[model samples]
Target: MILLDLFHYWVFIAILMMGFYTVIAKQNLIKKLLGLSLFQSAVFLLFIGIAKVDGGTTPILHPSISTEIFSNPLPQVLILTAIVVGISTSALGLAIVVRIKEAYGSIEEDQIQSKDESA
Candidate 1:
Protein backbone atom coordinates (compact mmCIF):
# COMPACT_ATOMS: atom_id res chain seq x y z
CA MET A 1 0.00 0.00 0.00
CA ILE A 2 2.80 2.36 0.79
CA LEU A 3 4.47 1.55 -2.49
CA LEU A 4 1.24 2.25 -4.30
CA ASP A 5 0.88 5.56 -2.56
CA LEU A 6 4.43 6.48 -3.54
CA PHE A 7 3.74 5.45 -7.09
CA HIS A 8 0.77 7.75 -7.25
CA TYR A 9 2.97 10.61 -6.17
CA TRP A 10 5.43 9.76 -8.91
CA VAL A 11 2.69 10.34 -11.47
CA PHE A 12 2.07 13.83 -10.13
CA ILE A 13 5.81 14.47 -10.06
CA ALA A 14 6.12 13.39 -13.64
CA ILE A 15 3.32 15.78 -14.62
CA LEU A 16 5.11 18.60 -12.83
CA MET A 17 8.39 17.83 -14.57
CA MET A 18 6.70 17.67 -17.92
CA GLY A 19 5.09 21.05 -17.35
CA PHE A 20 8.40 22.52 -16.27
CA TYR A 21 10.05 21.22 -19.39
CA THR A 22 7.30 22.61 -21.61
CA VAL A 23 7.59 26.04 -20.05
CA ILE A 24 11.37 26.03 -20.42
CA ALA A 25 11.59 24.59 -23.90
CA LYS A 26 8.58 25.95 -25.74
CA GLN A 27 8.82 29.26 -27.53
CA ASN A 28 5.11 29.87 -28.09
CA LEU A 29 3.30 32.03 -25.56
CA ILE A 30 0.19 29.83 -25.60
CA LYS A 31 2.24 26.73 -25.00
CA LYS A 32 3.92 28.41 -22.06
CA LEU A 33 0.55 29.26 -20.59
CA LEU A 34 -0.55 25.67 -20.98
CA GLY A 35 2.58 24.53 -19.26
CA LEU A 36 1.96 26.87 -16.41
CA SER A 37 -1.56 25.52 -16.04
CA LEU A 38 -0.27 21.97 -16.03
CA PHE A 39 2.25 22.86 -13.37
CA GLN A 40 -0.46 24.38 -11.22
CA SER A 41 -2.64 21.31 -11.62
CA ALA A 42 0.21 19.06 -10.58
CA VAL A 43 0.75 21.14 -7.50
CA PHE A 44 -2.94 20.90 -6.67
CA LEU A 45 -2.85 17.15 -7.14
CA LEU A 46 0.12 16.72 -4.83
CA PHE A 47 -1.34 18.96 -2.15
CA ILE A 48 -4.76 17.33 -2.09
CA GLY A 49 -3.23 13.89 -2.35
CA ILE A 50 -1.07 14.43 0.70
CA ALA A 51 -3.97 15.80 2.68
CA LYS A 52 -5.90 12.56 2.44
CA VAL A 53 -5.71 9.97 5.21
CA ASP A 54 -6.30 6.26 5.13
CA GLY A 55 -9.32 6.54 7.36
CA GLY A 56 -10.16 10.15 7.91
CA THR A 57 -13.40 12.03 8.11
CA THR A 58 -14.29 15.62 7.43
CA PRO A 59 -13.42 18.14 10.11
CA ILE A 60 -16.86 18.14 11.67
CA LEU A 61 -17.96 17.56 15.21
CA HIS A 62 -19.41 14.20 16.13
CA PRO A 63 -21.03 13.44 19.46
CA SER A 64 -20.55 9.70 19.79
CA ILE A 65 -17.18 9.10 18.20
CA SER A 66 -14.57 7.80 20.62
CA THR A 67 -11.60 8.23 18.28
CA GLU A 68 -11.90 10.88 15.63
CA ILE A 69 -9.39 11.27 12.83
CA PHE A 70 -10.59 14.33 11.05
CA SER A 71 -8.66 15.67 8.12
CA ASN A 72 -7.35 19.19 8.08
CA PRO A 73 -9.44 21.64 6.08
CA LEU A 74 -6.96 24.46 5.77
CA PRO A 75 -5.11 22.96 2.85
CA GLN A 76 -8.36 22.27 1.08
CA VAL A 77 -9.53 25.82 1.50
CA LEU A 78 -6.20 27.25 0.45
CA ILE A 79 -6.07 25.05 -2.58
CA LEU A 80 -9.57 26.14 -3.57
CA THR A 81 -8.44 29.71 -3.40
CA ALA A 82 -5.36 28.90 -5.37
CA ILE A 83 -7.45 27.22 -8.03
CA VAL A 84 -9.62 30.28 -8.42
CA VAL A 85 -6.59 32.50 -8.65
CA GLY A 86 -4.97 30.19 -11.10
CA ILE A 87 -8.03 30.30 -13.34
CA SER A 88 -8.20 34.07 -13.24
CA THR A 89 -4.51 34.35 -13.95
CA SER A 90 -4.74 31.93 -16.78
CA ALA A 91 -7.57 33.89 -18.33
CA LEU A 92 -5.62 37.11 -18.00
CA GLY A 93 -2.56 35.50 -19.54
CA LEU A 94 -4.52 34.18 -22.48
CA ALA A 95 -6.09 37.57 -22.98
CA ILE A 96 -2.64 39.09 -23.02
CA VAL A 97 -1.49 36.46 -25.45
CA VAL A 98 -4.39 37.26 -27.75
CA ARG A 99 -3.54 40.93 -27.68
CA ILE A 100 0.08 40.10 -28.32
CA LYS A 101 -0.89 37.98 -31.27
CA GLU A 102 -2.95 40.80 -32.69
CA ALA A 103 -0.24 43.41 -32.27
CA TYR A 104 2.79 41.31 -33.23
CA GLY A 105 1.15 38.91 -35.71
CA SER A 106 2.95 36.09 -33.93
CA ILE A 107 2.97 34.50 -30.50
CA GLU A 108 6.39 32.87 -30.59
CA GLU A 109 8.84 34.26 -28.08
CA ASP A 110 11.77 34.35 -30.51
CA GLN A 111 9.72 36.09 -33.12
CA ILE A 112 8.47 38.67 -30.65
CA GLN A 113 12.02 39.28 -29.41
CA SER A 114 13.30 39.76 -32.92
CA LYS A 115 10.47 42.08 -33.82
CA ASP A 116 11.05 44.16 -30.73
CA GLU A 117 14.79 44.28 -31.37
CA SER A 118 14.29 45.44 -34.94
CA ALA A 119 11.82 48.12 -33.89
Candidate 2:
Protein backbone atom coordinates (compact mmCIF):
# COMPACT_ATOMS: atom_id res chain seq x y z
CA MET A 1 0.00 0.00 0.00
CA ILE A 2 2.75 2.36 0.88
CA LEU A 3 4.66 1.53 -2.25
CA LEU A 4 1.54 1.93 -4.36
CA ASP A 5 0.92 5.31 -2.86
CA LEU A 6 4.41 6.33 -3.88
CA PHE A 7 3.56 5.56 -7.48
CA HIS A 8 1.46 8.69 -7.65
CA TYR A 9 4.65 10.69 -7.48
CA TRP A 10 6.29 9.09 -10.50
CA VAL A 11 5.35 11.93 -12.85
CA PHE A 12 6.87 14.57 -10.65
CA ILE A 13 9.99 12.44 -10.24
CA ALA A 14 10.28 11.96 -13.99
CA ILE A 15 9.88 15.69 -14.61
CA LEU A 16 12.49 16.49 -11.97
CA MET A 17 14.93 14.04 -13.52
CA MET A 18 14.29 15.41 -16.99
CA GLY A 19 14.88 18.94 -15.75
CA PHE A 20 18.16 17.91 -14.13
CA TYR A 21 19.27 16.09 -17.26
CA THR A 22 18.37 19.06 -19.42
CA VAL A 23 20.28 21.47 -17.21
CA ILE A 24 23.34 19.21 -17.17
CA ALA A 25 23.41 17.93 -20.73
CA LYS A 26 22.14 20.83 -22.81
CA GLN A 27 24.56 23.31 -24.32
CA ASN A 28 22.01 26.07 -24.83
CA LEU A 29 21.66 28.60 -22.06
CA ILE A 30 17.96 29.09 -22.78
CA LYS A 31 17.31 25.37 -22.49
CA LYS A 32 19.13 25.25 -19.19
CA LEU A 33 16.94 28.04 -17.86
CA LEU A 34 13.86 26.19 -19.06
CA GLY A 35 15.05 23.10 -17.24
CA LEU A 36 15.57 25.11 -14.11
CA SER A 37 11.97 26.30 -14.33
CA LEU A 38 10.81 22.73 -14.71
CA PHE A 39 12.81 21.72 -11.67
CA GLN A 40 11.24 24.48 -9.63
CA SER A 41 7.76 23.45 -10.76
CA ALA A 42 8.39 19.89 -9.66
CA VAL A 43 9.53 21.08 -6.26
CA PHE A 44 6.35 23.12 -5.95
CA LEU A 45 4.23 20.07 -6.72
CA LEU A 46 5.97 18.03 -4.04
CA PHE A 47 5.55 20.72 -1.43
CA ILE A 48 1.85 21.13 -2.20
CA GLY A 49 1.34 17.38 -2.11
CA ILE A 50 3.02 17.03 1.22
CA ALA A 51 0.93 19.81 2.67
CA LYS A 52 -2.32 18.07 1.82
CA VAL A 53 -4.25 16.07 4.38
CA ASP A 54 -6.59 13.12 3.97
CA GLY A 55 -9.57 14.89 5.52
CA GLY A 56 -8.34 18.32 6.32
CA THR A 57 -10.05 21.65 6.09
CA THR A 58 -8.82 25.20 6.22
CA PRO A 59 -7.46 26.41 9.52
CA ILE A 60 -10.71 27.66 10.92
CA LEU A 61 -12.94 27.05 13.88
CA HIS A 62 -16.61 26.14 13.80
CA PRO A 63 -18.86 26.56 16.76
CA SER A 64 -20.90 23.47 16.01
CA ILE A 65 -18.02 21.09 15.35
CA SER A 66 -16.05 19.92 18.33
CA THR A 67 -13.41 17.90 16.50
CA GLU A 68 -11.84 19.36 13.40
CA ILE A 69 -8.66 18.69 11.53
CA PHE A 70 -7.06 21.67 9.91
CA SER A 71 -4.17 21.52 7.51
CA ASN A 72 -0.93 23.29 8.29
CA PRO A 73 -0.74 26.75 6.73
CA LEU A 74 3.01 27.12 7.03
CA PRO A 75 3.94 24.97 4.04
CA GLN A 76 1.52 26.82 1.80
CA VAL A 77 2.90 30.16 2.91
CA LEU A 78 6.44 28.98 2.33
CA ILE A 79 5.60 27.67 -1.12
CA LEU A 80 4.09 31.02 -2.06
CA THR A 81 7.29 32.72 -1.04
CA ALA A 82 9.30 30.21 -2.99
CA ILE A 83 7.16 30.86 -6.06
CA VAL A 84 7.92 34.57 -5.88
CA VAL A 85 11.61 33.82 -5.50
CA GLY A 86 11.55 31.43 -8.40
CA ILE A 87 9.98 34.06 -10.63
CA SER A 88 12.66 36.54 -9.65
CA THR A 89 15.41 33.99 -10.23
CA SER A 90 14.11 33.06 -13.66
CA ALA A 91 13.74 36.68 -14.66
CA LEU A 92 17.29 37.43 -13.62
CA GLY A 93 18.60 34.36 -15.41
CA LEU A 94 16.80 35.28 -18.60
CA ALA A 95 18.20 38.81 -18.42
CA ILE A 96 21.68 37.35 -18.11
CA VAL A 97 21.08 35.03 -21.03
CA VAL A 98 19.95 37.98 -23.12
CA ARG A 99 23.14 39.86 -22.28
CA ILE A 100 25.23 36.82 -23.08
CA LYS A 101 23.51 36.43 -26.39
CA GLU A 102 24.05 40.08 -27.22
CA ALA A 103 27.76 39.83 -26.41
CA TYR A 104 28.52 36.38 -27.86
CA GLY A 105 26.07 36.36 -30.81
CA SER A 106 24.98 32.84 -29.77
CA ILE A 107 23.31 31.26 -26.76
CA GLU A 108 25.24 28.01 -26.96
CA GLU A 109 27.65 27.35 -24.12
CA ASP A 110 30.37 25.86 -26.37
CA GLN A 111 30.19 28.78 -28.74
CA ILE A 112 30.40 31.23 -25.86
CA GLN A 113 33.43 29.43 -24.45
CA SER A 114 35.17 29.40 -27.83
CA LYS A 115 34.51 33.10 -28.31
CA ASP A 116 35.88 33.83 -24.86
CA GLU A 117 39.00 31.76 -25.58
CA SER A 118 39.60 33.53 -28.92
CA ALA A 119 39.20 36.94 -27.31
Pick the TM-score winner.
2
Tens-place lDDT per residue, model 2, 67-87, is: 577787788889999999989
Model 1 C-alpha RMSD vs. true structure (Å) is 2.2
Candidate 1 residue-wise lDDT, 49-70, digit = tens: 8787778887778786655787
True lDDT of residue 72, candidate 1: 72
For candidate 1, give the lDDT of residue 89: 87
